[model samples]
Target: LYGAHLEGADLSGTHLEWANLSGTHLEGADLGGTHLEGADLGGAYLDGEISFAPAILRGAGARDINLEHIQCETFTEAFGDASVTLPDGYAAGEGKLSHWSPEKLDWENFYEAWRKWQAEQHPDLLPPYYTAED
Candidate 1:
């Protein structure tokens, strides 16, 4: 439903996996327990109240999405990963999404900071963040 307007729609538990919701208007839509995994929400206007968990947005594309007025079910629950780029004004702290008004660093810089800290404190474990395994 890309670019569609579904204002005030009761869409709880909808299986919207991989839907192209770019530029869509979902103001006041209920998305509780909705499966939005791998969905593309780029440029979507999402000012509605949503009941979301961190896994709800796993692998979802949310670049430039407007979540300025969105109220999730809980706060500080880790949401997206490195691929899911969050918008400005919102930040992923401790794996959860919250409003952070401080200077932000890109992923590479953040990773480098972590690596530097690891190299200084724990030199033995100063290596790749994860092992290459399939």
Candidate 2:
């Protein structure tokens, strides 16, 4: 269904795992309980009543994509491009929003920033490199 216009379609409880719905227009579609794990939604125009939780958006294009309304929190491969707009309190290379690409870093305090970010994003997880000490 690459680039197919399925706007306002009632697709609830459907299993569309790993389907190539790249660039598809899914505005106002009833995607509740729809399984889009490992699906390719690159460059897709998505808006209105939909949830993408637990969906493996690995390597999916994030150009002009906004997840503030969806509240997605999954990470895998390349997820952001130049036009990617993430939710509040989220950066390109942070927890559940790690971008598989080089981005601007606070070179002088990269480590400290990373540590702070980890703590803020995932306080329950262990530190990087499995260090017990903070």
Candidate 3:
């Protein structure tokens, strides 16, 4: 399925043994308790933007995949007895591996500032709560 959005689909506790799920957009899919034994998830985007923020990969085997750019809080409970092949520079551990803030990046900050400035030019679109008496 090209450019198909499969967000929030509950495929949990299903026996998908040896399934071919290459190049599928599984954004926000509930895969908890799903038996994905010997399944190939190569080049799959877990969070769409290279994020490892505690995906619902509980009881799924994610062996031999490039997970270098994934930034999660922890992967202790997710990857249980699974052979997960991460990228070269990343190691599985507890804590923040990467931090993404809109205020930190120069380009993002400038773009956000410009957007805010553009939005303020229109008075009608502005929320009424901001002009309310304190």
Candidate 4:
């Protein structure tokens, strides 16, 4: 269905493998758990308006898929293989957006900030279940 208007469609968990959905208008479509392996998404409108609660493309030929319009957050939620072209400044294998990966976080700084906040908010108060440590 090339160039078809499928706006706001609830296509969750649907198997659309090897389908020619090029240039399809999928705005606000619920593609959660949808299997789109080998589907032709070239020119497909899967921008920020759509909900891709993890569409599967494990073995899809996604080299031609244009991800310029797709949001990084939404794309990260999906499962893709090496064929899928990720947006610039992103990489696979982290199970999360590359920029937001745990390795990139400053845990020490965050812990210090949290400690300061806790000391200021509750100087002498600790929850009964929370055991304080030296």
Candidate 5:
């Protein structure tokens, strides 16, 4: 699911184990009980009214996730497992954070920034948008 546009998608109970979902946009996505074990969500966009209505993230690698953007009763109910790779705020089992509105997150800017981040991270690699031979 690399670089896929899944904005506001209902991805409940989807089996995405060990999949490479890098640079995917998941803003406002319904992730209720979505199995994300071992999934790589690096640079994926989750900054909006996301439904962790009760999601799963065991052993998943999630980077750059602004936990403040994910809407849930608490951080634990929305995410799980200490092994799951998350940002500094929600990386501990004893940690707990409350939900907040989407007034602070800038989705458009975040998405664009991720693209540039990828370029910087991998200088030799070319994005499909730029390397197409057509």
Candidate 6:
């Protein structure tokens, strides 16, 4: 498998060409530069509550996944023709999608900020003494 906790794993880089991975979680795994010719990954969660970000899905099949919520800033040429799937009540391409860039906040900083915001906005879902430092 190319990631953690995959239930049904048949991710042959050649067989799954141009598959869709929107809102899927494939954290802490390795895809070894697979050819994702035309996949879709809109609103996908490559990372978890930790600092680790998922490996790039460059050149994989990505064309119609929602990407408005992703933090990545640099997409591979594979995603050039893909369409970002939007959430309900939102326009198809109106989501916030970005690629990884050095200028963006570091993972630690981003996680901390995300935790803080989540705590403030949803106190019921907040854990006690939630700290992203590990």
Best by TM-score: 2
Per residue, candidate 1 scores C-alpha lDDT tens digits across 14-65 of: 8886677878888777777777655656667766464353336444544454
Q: Kindly give the stretch of ten consecutive residues in candidate 3 with the minimal lDDT sum.
A: 94-103
- Candidate 5 Cα errors over 4 Å, as ranges: 71-134
lDDT of 2 by residue, 1-134 (tens): 98999988878778775566768888777776676544545557777466454444433334445555655565343345324455677666566565422353332243344334435544443222435354
Model 5 C-alpha lDDT per residue in residues 33-60, reported as the tens digit of each score: 8876546566677765778656665444
Candidate 6 lDDT, 5-110, residue by residue in tens: 5323334344334444545655433333444433444334443221212334443323333444443433432222224443343332223322211123333453
lDDT for model 2 comes to 0.54
After TM-score superposition, what is the CA distance of residue 86 in candidate 2 from its true location, in Å?
Answer: 1.3
**TM of each candidate vs. truth:** 0.53, 0.57, 0.38, 0.51, 0.54, 0.33
Off by over 4 Å in 1: 48-55, 72-89, 92-134
* Cα lDDT, all candidates: 0.51, 0.54, 0.40, 0.54, 0.53, 0.37
Residue pairs that clash (backbone atoms under 3 angstroms), model 1: 77-96, 78-95, 78-96
Residue 48 in model 4: lDDT: 58
Q: For model 2, give the 10-residue run with minimal summed lDDT.
A: 99-108
Q: Between 2 and 6, whose TM-score is larger? A: 2
Q: Which portions of model 2 miss their true places by more than 4 Å?
A: 53-64, 74-82, 99-134
Model 2 vs. true fold: TM? 0.57
Q: Which stretches of candidate 6 lie over 4 Å from their true place?
A: 1-15, 48-74, 80-134
Which pairs of residues collide in candidate 3? 52-71
Error of 1 at 121 (Å): 27
Clashing pairs counted in every model: 3, 0, 1, 1, 0, 31
